[model samples]
Target: MGESDPFIQRVQDVMNAPPLMVEEKESIQHTAEKMVDQQASSIVVVNEKQRLHGIITEKDLVQRVIAADKKTGTAADIMSASPYTISRRAYYYEAMSSFLMNGIKHLPVVNEDSTSQVVGMITLSDLLKKQNRGKFDVLREIEASSSESLADVKFAIYEVLGHLIDDGIPILHIMKVVTNLYDRLIRHCTELALEEVKEEIGSPPCDFAFFLMGSGGRHEQFMMTDQDHFLVYEEPAKEEDRQTNDAYFKKLGEQIVYWLETAGYKRCDGNMMASAPGWRGTIDHWEDRIRTWGLRATNENILLGQNFLAFRWIYGSEKVRDQFVRGVSRQLGKSKIFLRRAAELEKNVPVPVLDHPIRALFRVKKEGMDIKKQALFPFHHSLQILSAEHGILGETPEEMIEHLKEKRVLDEPFADELLYAYEVVLHIRVTQSWDRYKLEEENSSEVSFRQMKSRDKEALIQALKAIRSLQTKAVATFGMA
Candidate 1:
């Protein structure tokens, strides 16, 4: 009893066997080369029945024949006669330690009968990546969400990202998925807020547009972005209409923001909150405001263009948002005057750039520039303006890219790359936010280009450079495209 293997449970826990693989009769050299190409350390040797044969690994290559200056042509002469075997019924720890202690990467697993064909193979790296603390909490929350528990749904959003942290899923893909759920959660909160106050808000078709700006608008929101949004309703023609529900919508918007903050998103710092009167306006008023924003270029508009083009709708009727889009778009396309103004505003928006010459001449600014401002902002805002000009309606930057691509303004490859870059930027932002918030660093809202890790920093810089290169080409050919 005392001598029994402690790893039996672990090996049995993770199912293992073999993969759909090439047969053993295949050229040994071909199989060994394929193994190296797949980044697999060893090849699972099998016959037509898919029964395990002696395995061939790097060790076999170096120690047995390759090192002896023998050609890797024949499997029979070079392959080891007896390969180590572990029952599929064994535990993960046993398989893992066997792989680790023996320095083998691939292990063929068999059945409890000790003679069944090979099943699945387990890798140490994959097993480690899948290990996490909140795995069960996340699964439980998913179940709860299926049961219509809003609280669990809210908790799931936070838990998913946290579990991602624990599981070491690449930050990029995790952020892309997180971005999806964040919008869903925010929309859920908006509906809940409206339901809570609907009794007090009599129907006026007083349609409201939920305007999300900055990272939220870009679908690039990190873990830290508060919902920087606004609410717009059609101006009431009647005095009674005006007097009754204005305060109620204001209160409702505030409650929605409050609920979102409680759920996880912090409040916007610039007081760009939907609760603010400056951000809350009627449909007609919003139209006029958007026109003014398009026609008149100002320092504030450029200072905040990163946030401005990031503007979009998170919830409410798409028709209402559609109408707003029409107003904004028609004005943009019809008036070359306004279009030119918009184009000028685009140039007005400065991005992070390192003068390669200047950096060589002198030291580069330690922080570089805000990558969002320099890289993501240009592409993000250009798409927004382009959409408004093209009469394309979209609630998020991802939507805008799709819309433009459908219009043939964007090629699939370039659009795909842009979206990939945007996701990577969001990944970088989330990590930066988490670190800053934890360290109590100032300006967590803006992630500095320098804060990125060496690989990430280089990748982002390359992304920014590519974006600028493309932007220049587009500008030269299309003129404000």
Candidate 2:
């Protein structure tokens, strides 16, 4: 399950090539026959240039032709247009992501050089056939789950994570794969909550967006994660309508939290969840709150704003989410005082000093450090402050660093150094957390330096140094030096 493993291999390595295809003008009868002859579940639709036009699957055939009772039609008439596709160069995880996100089973593979040239076709079955059952079983289970059975799916995730770790998969890739599963789990919970809410109260009164903040928002969760979410509904034209909308959303939020908790995510101790009043509001209310956070710049206000600044929309109206995000960026752009205060606070937080093993041997007991607080936080907090100041709305620290690099706000070499340091720190944190989970210990971020391999200890020390440098740079950038 290492890099050379087929599970991590390129799509071209596993995709079924010489894909069954039918010309656009081919009769529907002929298309069905081709599928039957090839024993294919799906066939690609192509035009004169051997380029992909669309795709036809058994579902399409049954629903579009058979169910419609159509006597005759061309492939072009019934084919699903602009179907999703993947590149031959993509990894298996990419295909898995596409399938999971789009809820598509068959993915036509295209040539990297010629984007439309059908190189192969991959199906969910293809992936399932190649990888270990444990890896994909969670996805199927999550998708099929509709009840409290979803609670079991959360435990299944750790098993999958263990397998990935054993396979020597990169921590970052593991993060993406696990994040997708969690996203699906959260989305499924949201759906169930919505259904219950609909049954209890009719349809929603207005458009709204449910979003995640903190680590979940940044797609950085590795082991257990707590709830850090909010809701933003469209402003009602009338006061009465506003109250109605608020009541409906309040119930909806509570139900969502209930389902997520059932699925094993703990409630945020800080109460940064949709179930809380302050976390769910109209766009106007949210905008005003954002302005207040900047205008006030109190310690608590800055912390609250910092959490919200990492928000990523999970469900509901993208239009609403975009509007809210735009409002946040606009407010942040004008909040120089808030940014400066945030930087100053971040600068004042002490990073843990990793003592050399030789220097620590004389101590009565070895010291354990919270890698998250000491290393990861400095990297993320610094980037977060910088990103907010520059109006760069990248959700994750990596994205923020790249955005800053693009804007020339951070020099290329320095940004690269910061990214590498962040990765090293994150790798250590996730692995340590995973190890603790396996021992059935309480979820803790503490990493014992004495237990780490010499190389790891050295790597962590270097990462912490880089983080400190970034903190210094952030303070200077905000004129707090």
Candidate 3:
């Protein structure tokens, strides 16, 4: 049905009234009580013409009033003047995203002339009604695992995207949500590792660091992303010499990886795990690896090594993550060779494009789309190459876009537009994979974006095209890629 359907129309009619507007000069105590009595979380602050000026919520009442030891006068002082808002023509689905993401209870709907006459308020609960859920096999395993497997976590992660897709969640917000979950999973895994293995390290709490790279780095990881990761450490001066520190870091790697695999992330196909002495390095050792990996860029072995680029501190000391990030920055300044190699590797992975004459758009069937080999990976590699060149280590495509744009590689409008495309592809991939897996039509190793609906297929293909264009622009600017 169109957005004007009876269901939406009724919801709008009832929800259309602006919160009981109290003028900006209204007393805090009076407004707070009015809000409570009206069963509202917030009230609009408006000028006499009813145009939106600001807002105050329950949070303001507590944080500004009670916690700060302020009386009724202070609550309104804490109100937000710059809240996110939407226009009247916006679809209910559009508000769904703003509600959950912007963390607002009410969106002051304004008219064309910019009068915030309190046309509507969209509650989080209002949008939750549209959410759809799909059963995931991995959730059962995640709960059951004694040591959370990265593999199970990966699948569980997949289900999150599936949930968003089935519920018709906006694609852009879904990307953010999924990336946030990926980040959270690694963090939780790190916490689990820290708790399980800290005594072995024996220093104070702040001695180690975790690195999540590749798909995890780009924040665009899909359901089937393999664990391509590494671990690095610093010399624990408190523990005396290098050997003791080395042993401690080594054991930490074994423990973390054991749990990761047992939990579900398959060991890296290249075996570049922290368990590998080559990958589990002290600061000097890591410096050597980065330099060598860059210098020896042509070797197939090191070419495969770029997958390790998805580094983030999942556990250990913030100092370690910070130090390593700094080292990366300095080291990356010299990595033109490595960035070039990454671009060469991308050529091996052909992006599926539309059979359309323009070739500007990807032509995809409603069958199996190689969202990975074609659209996802090429864009990922190009972005990675660009990110490394600029010494920016963004954990996801969305992050990369921001950093890239800030550095002048991509303009703001295009960055946003391309990210939107990338999200649509992810949403489709997760939904299709979930349904196929549900029916036992397929399992591991075969899920892809080919199963998307036609309209979705067109959009996804179009998105791939946009990413490809952005990547091309990035390559030209960076020159080496």
Q: Of the candidates shown, which would achieve the greatest TM-score relative to the real structure?
A: 2
**Residue range with the least summed lDDT across 10 consecutive positions in model 1:** 1-10
lDDT of 1: 0.61
Model 3 lDDT per residue over 1-481, tens place: 3221211333354354655677777788888878988988877887666677788878878888889887756334777986777766554544554554455677776554565556766665555555331222333333334552455566666655665666666655655556655565555565566667765555433366677776666555555455666777776567566776677667777766766666566788767677778777777677777788788876574456556665655556678778888887777677667676666665545465554533233243434546665666677667777787777773566777888889887788888877777776666555566677778786432344334456765676578778777567655654534
The residue-by-residue lDDT of candidate 2 on 194-239, one tens digit each, is 9999999989898899998888888888766889999999999788
lDDT, residue 46, candidate 2: 96
lDDT on C-alpha atoms for all candidate structures: 0.61, 0.83, 0.63
The lDDT of model 2 is: 0.83
Q: Which candidate, 1 or 2, would have the higher TM-score against the true structure?
A: 2
**Model 2, residue pairs in steric clash:** none
Cα displacement (angstroms), candidate 1, residue 381, comes to 2.0
lDDT-sorted candidate list, best first = 2, 3, 1
